[model samples]
Target chain A: MTIEQGSYESPIDRSVFDQFAARLAGDLPRPTVVETMTALLRQEIIDGAYGPGTRLPEESLSKRFRISRHSLREAMRLLVHERLLVHETHRGVRVRTVDVHDLGEIFAARRVVECAAVERASDDGAALAVVRAAVREGQQAAEAGVWATVGTADLHFHQAITALAGSSHLDELMRRLLAELRLALHVLADPRRFHEPYLERNDEIATLLERGDRTAAASALRTCLDDAERQLTAAVAA
Target chain B: MTIEQGSYESPIDRSVFDQFAARLAGDLPRPTVVETMTALLRQEIIDGAYGPGTRLPEESLSKRFRISRHSLREAMRLLVHERLLVHETHRGVRVRTVDVHDLGEIFAARRVVECAAVERASDDGAALAVVRAAVREGQQAAEAGVWATVGTADLHFHQAITALAGSSHLDELMRRLLAELRLALHVLADPRRFHEPYLERNDEIATLLERGDRTAAASALRTCLDDAERQLTAAVAA
Candidate 1:
């Protein structure tokens, strides 16, 4: 079965499909077929196309991408390296499941990175603009009742916060952290209830940064992250 | 020529050789030949065996390991993923060079991780014991004038600090950060002068932590990181 047949189906799955259509329409560069496939599969996995513990059918993926099994393995290996997929000896490759233990550790990391980013975030106009734009995107998505897109926007908002620190290394760390976070968040039973409250908090933090109130911004972000971790932990435990 | 001929020869090179001898004598488990090779190469690179920009001789390495070119390639790929080595077209794989820009970004990440780790580090007896042990190791190495071992001890000190945060992810991030740091630090003119003074400061931070003075400990760490970054950036720029 394709990823669309996975246990957790999102309304925003079409957005990922549209990205594929756009890529095929020559809107983006494809360095190699394997890389292109890897990028798309990574997005699919992060977008919750395949829920936790779903076994990926190697034959079907190879056939679906019209690539050789060797190429498919290369793509899967990349995801495996990213910890988004796991290859067990006898079980083949399956989506990695995030446990409550992992959730706690991940949030600990997030608290360290995100709070620090906000504290040191420079008042660069371009960086702050990205934060505002992400907030706007999340607001619009929430208005349209698209929680998955809202989740993506929230990640972008955090990414923008890290960018304000002016360190690509931290930005990359935030990116990977959020991807794992997306996996952990897939366990939440009500996506709308979980994501809606964070939208306003994101805006509040962004506004605090815009006003040069970094102390308040950092404090707000720490609270936001703590609340999120508790909610995610409770959901994942269930 | 082997890695011993690399431009930056260290007295610690013999230490790496000793590890190889011990491995051969079955003092350590060889999970797989490729993994064994990868771990050895990773340690060598981080230990400044092959200095920054030193081209790794694929042919000699394959011969020395008695492994096929494919297995060597797999091992090299792992280091490449860790950002310890870069593979350029037509140039083969060589040790990655950390420039001024990269050094600045790396220290920024370090500040976020290490400082935050100190701020919230638990006063667990075992964790604090690791901190004191690493501090003692650095002091002993410094007294013996083994600056290279001192450097290793210094990294261990920081690694122990992050461990006190009780998150394996941050610990892993610190490992990668410190490896890249070793590459950047290879530019320093005097290893003794660079690592010597930090031994006392390491003791200071550990003492502060043991006293349950996390705020002071974090403050001291932030200052230490700032000074080191300034020194490293100046050396790298030169």
Candidate 2:
């Protein structure tokens, strides 16, 4: 009998391994299974479901998610690429530990890339709307004391700004870096310590872009990044 | 038979896969059978064993690598996460296509990261040697008319320069971006079309660095990037 290569079109069913892959035919919709799985694990990581430097068992996750071990492994590999998890050969996968240097580098790269995107947004009015909405959402989240929501909204604000640059390539690179940055923020001493000031700084940077002052917007963004870096560094040290 | 919750590390016989990974793991090596397999595939992509947009069959690769289908699949998952390969479920994995737009974004991100590293390298004399050696190697490869070798050496040059910035985090990001860039370059027509001018530009930038002209060095680097972008765009379109 010829071995079937598996189905090419379908949303990866949560049931069987081959079916799950068949589902991932083309571009998946937002909030797809992989994304849902990512969000769940992200919350768990932030909530300390798994401690830093702790191995995450594939078998256990499979049972917990009610999915096959194969699907769970695929999810883990994605996280491993994101720097949220570290996969060791015989040792198994574990939550990645973020140190002071890791934080510094992440923020440094973020500042350069994000600030450039903000500058680009000033030239494209359409992109500014997305950034403005993200800032508004961030403010609302901060007022409600939803630190996790605020952190995520803050990323959306910047991501919207980058999208204004009209480069899918830049967006892809920025998205990966932002994912790692968000994961690092999750490990800070108190979530509010990082998210609270971000609301104000994001507003200032957004306002600069809305007013079409690209230089001022970029400078404000740089300062905002500096503040975030300082806070993250202090939190990691503490 | 009951499966254990955890398995101990067991000695496995060396396979052809071990040879490449063994070399890669030399400096703080993190070897696992899966990672070894991933590295092998990466080398193949870099070596142009698989052309762009060509579907990579799991069964074919598994048989060729002399590894189990499961192990090969796992490796493919890792590369997919790394953006080295794109997976479309039943359609199988294929080398990712890097268009002119992708190249532009990659270079833009590289400039931001690499220039910052060069600025940092100004204060660290010890790291200058790495850049110097890479420059020499790049020049020699160009002289020998080995465009692919020149491209690979050029990456090492920039990687060394970025490492001098003293951030493992940036180094990691650059590593990922560079791998994608290498694959993208493979599809561009005539390596010599890009390589010849690239060598001259690299020399100019290196000379500026040697003279302690940070401003001039950064400027020269940007110009070189612009030229490279134009060549890549022309090649892709042609």
Candidate 3:
């Protein structure tokens, strides 16, 4: 069932794999083994075990995860639907290869959805507190020099901003968008370069929103997204 | 495999099914028969062949659709993923029963995503024309006294407004939202009561957008969504 020889690369870095293991180790007892496999495999993708465009043969993955082929197929099916992986009819699945064009469109969507969220949000002290907490977390992660964790915290800031609109559906939508955004981030030559500059901008947004200057916060978010889009586009294009 | 006896119902009214049949009949030569079956079954849900909260027993449905159990499972799996159906552990599947609390959250989300879309949309004559076209279609459907179709057209109108943001991700998100909305619509005893007043409101918003009054259009959309939410909430409360 191992369809290819070169695509599947087991993670050799114990330190990095340990982080993923610790984070996902506490997922309440999964209903099915497929659920567990999906979580682990997705974390592997995020941890960069398998690089972009690598084939994820179901036969190999089921063996690696110690699950049945049926369970593996279910996990792959969900990932494919999430656009994290692409399923080819005759060739099987691979990590999605997001081009610069897709990244550009995704950022444009982020601008539309996220900006609207901040702009329309009411001046709730409690909501602003949550967003500020996410920004502070991002800064602390950056101070600790954990760039990968900082990106996670940065995504949390954006998610918190979306939450201000008081829509669970939009929150779900932003979660999906951010996952896709991460895949796009994985394409960069240096993922750290992609997230480092945005920490300060996130702080600015949190501060603006706290001051009830939502219009200014939204404008800042738009520019921040534009700058990130330009940076990613240049990286991918290069 | 015949696990249930009374859960399957073959839709007798081909006229209603025909509308769904035609709309979905040209799904571009499905790669697998499961894809075709999924589309048709989804349409049946939309057409109310299987009412909300009714058990969709796998064994019975496989027989009704004249497909293998494997293919039926595949289709049901996709629908469950879309939130159109709920799969209970050991109880098989049923059309999702959306609660009033969920309806409030979903409508609130619609206001955030859709109002932001209209408010920020470019005053493009061509884009506005497409929106106008959807409004015209809704009016025509209303004039012909087809409130169900009018509801469909109104969904299209809101979709068009989201499209004005020109972000495909938002469009995909809205598509998901609208599907959930249709599920909510299914809970209504009189669908006409939900859609009739919105037709005029749709026209007004379209006119506002055409005149470059994006603020007015957005305000109108917010009110429209609020009114619909109130209507649905009252209906569900009753």
Best by lDDT: 1
Q: lDDT tens string, model 3, B1-238?
A: 1112246666443354335445655664324556567787887787777667778877666766567776677678778878888887678888876778988887887887788789779767787888899999988988898888988898899899988988898888888778877877765777687788887888899988888888988888898888888887787666
| Model number with the top TM-score | 3
Clashing pairs in 2: A10-A23, A11-A23, A12-A20, A12-A23
Give every prediction's interface RMSD. Answer: 1.9, 3.2, 1.5
Q: Rank the candidates by TM-score, best first.
A: 3, 1, 2
TM-score of chain B of each: 0.87, 0.84, 0.87
The predicted structure with the larger TM-score, 1 or 2, is 1
Of 2 and 3, the candidate ahead on TM-score is 3
Cα-based lDDT at residue A122, candidate 3: 83
- In candidate 2, stretches whose alpha carbon ends up further than 4 angstroms from where it belongs are A1-43, A46-49, A119-122, A161-169, A187-194, B1-15, B21-30, B115-122, B187-189
Which pairs clash in the backbone of model 1? none
State each model's CA lDDT, in order: 0.80, 0.72, 0.78
Which candidate model has the greater DockQ, 2 or 3? 3
- Model 3 Cα lDDT, one tens digit per residue, A122-206: 8788888899999989889888998888888988999999889888888888887888778766656665777888888899888
Residues B183-229 of candidate 2: C-alpha lDDT, one tens digit per residue: 77776667777776767677777777877887788777777777777
Worst 10 residues of 1 chain A by lDDT: A1-10
Tell how far residue B135 is off in model 1, in angstroms.
0.9
Compute each candidate's TM-score over C-alphas.
0.85, 0.81, 0.88
lDDT computed for candidate 1: 0.80
The CAPRI category of model 1 is: medium
Q: Count the clashes in each prediction.
A: 0, 4, 0
